[model samples]
Each structure stands twice: as structure tokens, then as C-alpha cells.
Target: MIIDIIGDIHGYADKLIGLLTQLGYQHNGQCFMPPKGHRALFIGDLIDRGPQQIKTLDIVFAMLDADVADAVMGNHEYNALAFATLDPEHAENYLREHNETHTRQHEAFLAEVPFGSERHHYWLKRFCEIPLWLETDSACFVHACWDVDSMAILKPLLTRDNCLTPQALTLTSKKHTPMFDALERVLKGVETPLPKGIVMVDKEGTTRSRVRVRWWLDDLDNRPIREIARAPHSAIAQIPLDTKAEPIDFTLKTDKPIFVGHYWLTGTPTPLSTQVVCTDYSAAVDSGYLTCYQLDTECPLPLSPNNFVQYRHT
Candidate 1:
């Protein structure tokens, strides 16, 4: 079977439609139909941070209903579920705090689907339906890093199809728990604390003491911080790692090729490593693109740069 691995859309419906058409999908009266023998696998983050939040979901929902596409739950989607769910112990609070930062980050989605509205509830259910990760015989697809340990921890907690259950959600919602940390790594990628007293301003303008690292790379001890971390700013990316910083002992252990999104990668779309490819290209920004990696299951391995398809901005 052939699969097109799509990246984080972040509510760019026009780019999604454009990328679909570029991939040879036809727009029938109902929805976009995949090319013969091809299916689209979205890496998620379908809502928030851009215009046309509901419209983006409408297209994805239509494709899913038609069985032409499948999706994994992005960090944003999981956050939405938490925001909508009330904490059973505290009737006044939600699983996700309604703080200024979270509200600002999620305001676009909440604006379109107001709290307690039927539409809001509808999307929340859909979010739960999206699996945390998808695995086929030849490859794996997830929103972020696909850690073996984290997957093992979450396997029994998730449903047979790998979607989240209400109990699983509640269990994973409690901060600082093993389950919570596992979920965070899977959805948001692996992060390592920077050297003491060192901080970096992220693309979102938030100061972060910990930086997301490329989990697929091994022997990072020899690599510079610019090569090991996903710091968006060049100045921050160049900082030397302090000797006191903890070493990253984990690395990708899978033989199967993995496809992931969530990192706002820039430049020409390419394979992150021989065993993995990141499809996200910062599509939510004005100059960014929506990307897809064309994969043929019959010969899936050692992903190449030639198969990347980027949305052409007209």
C-alpha cells in the first residue's frame, strides 16, 4: 500500500487542500479522494495557531469518514481534550489549567468552538478517536518522537486500536506522573535541560530552560548543541553545552522507518535521518509550507529526500 505522510497543518485549510491536490487527490462533491491505492496519514495538530480552524477539521473529518485518511493525536489535540474535560476531584477546574498562557495558545480553537458547545464536544470526541501513534508492518507514524519505552508504558492504557480511553486520559493528565511524562515525550518529543543558568527564547517567544533534541541521533556527546537541539534561533542554537549538563542516553532503537511532525522545521523538506523523516515545515507561518512524505510500503526503509512534496503557494 502507498501512504502519504502529512505534516502538522495548524489550521491552514487552504494549504491542506493545496497539498492534497498536489498529491493527485481529486475533490469530489463530498471530499478529497486519494489517488488509486494511496492513503493520507496526517501527523496531526489539525487545529489552533492559524485561521480556518473549523474548516481544516472539516476537510480532515470528511477524508476520515471516507476512509481515505487517518490521523494521530497531536499535542494540541490532546491539550484540547484536557481543556474540555473537568477534573472529577475539583469540580471548578479542568485537567488542563485555564491559565493566561494556555488560553492564549488555545484561544483560536476555543473561539471557533466555544466551551460547552455541541461543536466543542464533538471535536473533543474526535480527538480521543485519533490514535497516539500508528504502526504498520513497514513503518511507524506519530506526531513527535516515537520512543520505545514510552510506547510500552502507554500500550495497555490505550485501546486496542491505540486511541485513548477516558480512564487513560485521566491517568495521564496528572502532572509529574510516569504516565504523564511518557505521554509528553510521545506527543511533544524528547527534551533535555540546558546547562544551569542558560535559557533560550523559543520561536513562540517563550523562554525555555529545556530544549527539544533530535532523539534519532546517537552519540550526541560528540555533536555540538547546534546539531543536537531543535533551537529555532541561531544564536541560542550555537551555545556550547556545559560539562554539568546531563547526557542524553536515549536514541531511536527501531528498525522500521518512522515519520513524525510537531517540530517546526525550516528549509527544504528532507529526511531527518536515514531511519526517520520530519514532515512539518512551519505551515502556520506566512512564508512556511505544508509538506508530505510519499511512502510506498513495499519498499519502505532508509527514507530519501526525493519523495517530499511541498504545497505550492499561488
Candidate 2:
């Protein structure tokens, strides 16, 4: 079977439809289907940060329901669930505090589906059903990093079908817990503390002291800070090499291919490594493109730009 590994679609239904069409998927009233027995494997982040949130969800949901596609849960989906759920300890508060920052991050989604509406609750139930990752005989897929150790720690905690249960979500939501750390590493990627008194503004204009590291790299001890960052910044290269920071050991080696989408990358899409591919090309932004990787089951995965397909937003 040929699999189309798709990137994050942050409410850009038009681009998604365009990409599906480009991949020879025809709409059969309810959902798109490929003619040659191909399937779409979505990397999640299906909602938020765009104009058509509910429409996007409908398409993705229909595809999944029709057995045309499978998806992993993105951090946005996790946060959405937490935001909608009331904290058991504090009846008035949400699992994820409903502060300005949290609300703003989810504003687009909430605008389309009101917080307590029937539609909101329906989707929340579906969101919780999404698995954090998918592993097959030949490949693995996740929203972010596939840290072996982290997944090992999370394996026993997951439900029989490899999904996070309500109790698991609550446990992972707590600060400094092993579950929290493992979930963070898998969903958000590995992060490293910046030098003393150093902070950088993220895409949301929030200043953060910790930056997501390039977890695919196994040897970070000798690498420069700029080289170790997944989202490199001009200021990061200026940080002193002697600055103390925690060491990251990404020692997961596998022959099977791995696909992920979360980092808002731009430019022409390509395989991250011989066996690793990141299809997210900042599709939520005006200048970004919706990207995908076409994988053939008969052959071993190739690290080339030729397999990358995209639909540019116009």
C-alpha cells in the first residue's frame, strides 16, 4: 500500500482539499478517497490558527470514519481537551487554566465551536480517541519527537489501543511528573534551557527561555547551540559555547522510517534524515505550504526531495 504522510493542517481546508486532489483523491460525497488503494496518514494539528476550523475537523473526521485516513493527536488537540475539561480538584477551573494566553492560543477553534456547545463536546470525545503515535511494521508516526525512552515510559500507561485515557491525561498534565515529561517530549519535542538571562520571543510573541532541540541528533554534546536547535534563530548562534546546559541523549536508532509534524518549517520540503521526515511546512501561515510525503510499501524509504508534494496557499 502507498501511504501519503500529511503535515499539520491548521484549519486550512481549502489547501487540504487541493493537496488531496493533487494526490488523485476524489471526493465521494462524504470524504476523499484515493483511486489506487492509497491511504493518508495525517500528522495531526488539525485545528486552530486559521479561518475554517470546524470544516477542517469535519473533513478529517469523515476521512477517519471512512477508513481513508488515520491521525495522531497534536499538542493543539491535547490542549483543547484540557481547556474544555473542568479540573476535578477545582470545579471552577479547567484542566488547562483558561487564562488569556491559553484562550488566545485556542481563540480560532473556540470561535468556530463554542466552549460548551454540543458540537464542542462531540469533537472533544473524538479528540481523546486519537492516539499519540502510530507504529507499523515498516514505519512510525508521531506529532513530534519519537524519543524511545520516553515512549517506553509511556507505553504501559496507555490504554489497550495505545490511546491516552482521561486518567492518563490528568496525570500527564501535572508539572514535574514522569508522565508529564514523557508526554512533553513526545508531543512537544525535547527542550533545552537557554543561557542565563536569555529569552527569545516565539511565533506567538511569548518569550520563552527553553528552546526545542533537534532530538534526532544523537551527538549534541559537541554540537553548537545553533546546530542543535530545530528552529534555529540568529540570536541562538551568539550564545557562548561555554554556557552550561543540560545534555540531550537521543539514542533511538531504527531502520524503519519515522514521520512527524509540529515544527513550523518553511521553504522546499525534504526528508529530515535518511529515515526521518518532517512534513509540516508552516501550512497555517500565509506564505507556508501544505506538504506531504508519498511512501511506497514495496521499497525502502528514500531521503530525497522528489517524494515531497505540496499545495501552496494562494
Candidate 3:
């Protein structure tokens, strides 16, 4: 089968339409359908961070309903569910606290869906239906890191379709639990603690003590922090190489290709490794592009830059 593994749309409908058209998918009044029996595999984050959130949802859900696409839930979708769901234990509070930080992160989505509208609740339920990962004989797909240990821990908790059950969702929301940790690693990727007393401001201007690591690489402990980090800022390079942080051992070697999105990578799209490809190019940003990897079951999994198709947001 020919699968177009697409990255985070983040509510960019025009770009999504353009990319679909570029990939030879024609809108048949209700949903977009690809020629030549191609299918789109979305790596979630369908809402938030851009204009036209409802339109984005309309297109993606239409495709899904039409059996033209499959998807895994992204962190943004998970967060939306948490923010809207009330805590069973503490009935007054939500699963995710509605503070300034969380609100800011969700503002774009709320602007379109509102807080407690029917549309918001409807999408929340739809988010729950999305699986956390996908696997086939030829390849694997996840929104972020595919840590073997985390997947093992999560497998029993998921439904037959690989989605989190209501019970699993409640359990995973608690901090410092095994379920929480596993969910974090899969949806958000692995992070390493910065050198003692070191802190860096992220792109969002939030000071963070941990830095996102390139968990797919081997020998991460021996590598310098700057080289293995997914988005190493200038301030991080200044941290001494001998800072003595233990390497996180999350790499899962596999023969099949793995595709993921959520890192918000920039520049020309390319494979992260021979077996791993990241299609996200920060599509919600002004200079970002909605990226997709064209995969053919007949071909080997090692991706080429030529297979990447994108529609840059002007």
C-alpha cells in the first residue's frame, strides 16, 4: 500500500488542502480521496496553534470517516481531553488544570471551539478514539518517541484498537506514576536533565530544567549534549561537556521503518536516521511547512529526501 505519513497539521487547513492536492487527492464534495489507492496516515495534533481549527478538524475527520486515513493521537489532542475532562476524585478540578500556561497553550483551539461548547466536547471524544501508535508488517508510526519499555508498559492498558481506555486515561493523568511516565515518553519524547543549576529558556520562553534528547540515537551518554539534543539552543552548548549526565537508554532497534512527528523540526525535511523519519516542520509557525513522507510497501524503509512532500505556509 502507498501510505502518505503526514505530520502535525496544527489547524493549518489551507496548507493541508494544498498538500493533499499536491499528493493527487481530490475533494469529492465530502472528503479528500487519493488516486491510485494511496492512504494518508496522520500523526495527529490536528487542532491548536493556527487559524481554522474547525476547518482542519472537518477535513481530517471527514477523511477518517471515509476510510481514507488513519491517525495516532498527539500531545495536543491529549492535552485538550485532559483540559476538558473533570477530575473524578476532585470534582471541582479538571484533569489538566486550567492555569495560564495551559490556557495559553490551548488558546488557539479554544478561540475556534470555545471552552464548553458541543463542538469542544465532540472533538474531545474523537481524540479519545485515536490510538497512541500504529504498527504494520513494514513500518511503525507514533506521534513521538517509540520507547520499547514505555510501549510494553502501555500495551496492557490500551484497548484492542490501541487507544487508552477511560480507566487508563484516569490512571495516566496522575503525576509521577508509571503510566504517566510512559505516556510522557511516547507523546512528548525523552528529556534529559540539564547540568546542575543550569536552566534554559525554550522557544516558548519558558525556563526548563530538562532538555529534549534524541532518544533514537545510540551511545547518547558519550555524545555531547549539544549534538544529541533535538533542539539544542546556544545556551545549552555552553554547559560543560563533562557535566556528567547519564544517557537515557530509550533506543529500540528495529528492522522496520518508524515514522513520528511532534519535534517541530525546521529546515529541509529529511530522515532522522536510516529507519526513522520525522515529518513535522513546525507547521503552525509562519515559516513552517506541513510535511509528509511518501512510503511505498514495495520499497525499502530507508527514507530519501526526495520522498518528502510539503506545502509551505506563506
Show the lowest summed lDDT stretch of 10 residues, model 2: 232-241
The digit string of per-residue lDDT tens for model 1 on 1-314 reads 88999999998899999999999999899999998999999998999998899999999999999999999999999999998888888889999999888898999898899999999989898888899999999999999988889988988999999899988888889988989988999999887787777877765667778878788886766455666777677545546653333577566778999999998888998898889899999998978899999999999976889999999786
Candidates' C-alpha lDDT: 0.88, 0.85, 0.87
* Candidate 3 C-alpha lDDT tens digits along 27-128: 999999987769999997888888989999999989999999999999999999888888899999988999888899999999989899998888888888
**Predicted candidate 2 versus true structure: per-residue lDDT over 106-129, tens digit per residue:** 999999999899999999999988
What is residue 309's positional error in candidate 2, in angstroms?
0.3
Query: Candidate 3 vs. truth: CA RMSD?
Result: 1.5
Each candidate structure's count of clashing pairs:
0, 0, 0
Clashing pairs in 3: none
**Best candidate (score: lDDT):** 1
Output the better candidate (1/3) by lDDT.
1
TM-score of each prediction: 0.95, 0.95, 0.96
Candidate 3 weakest ten by summed lDDT: 232-241
Q: What lDDT is reached at residue 69 by model 1?
A: 93
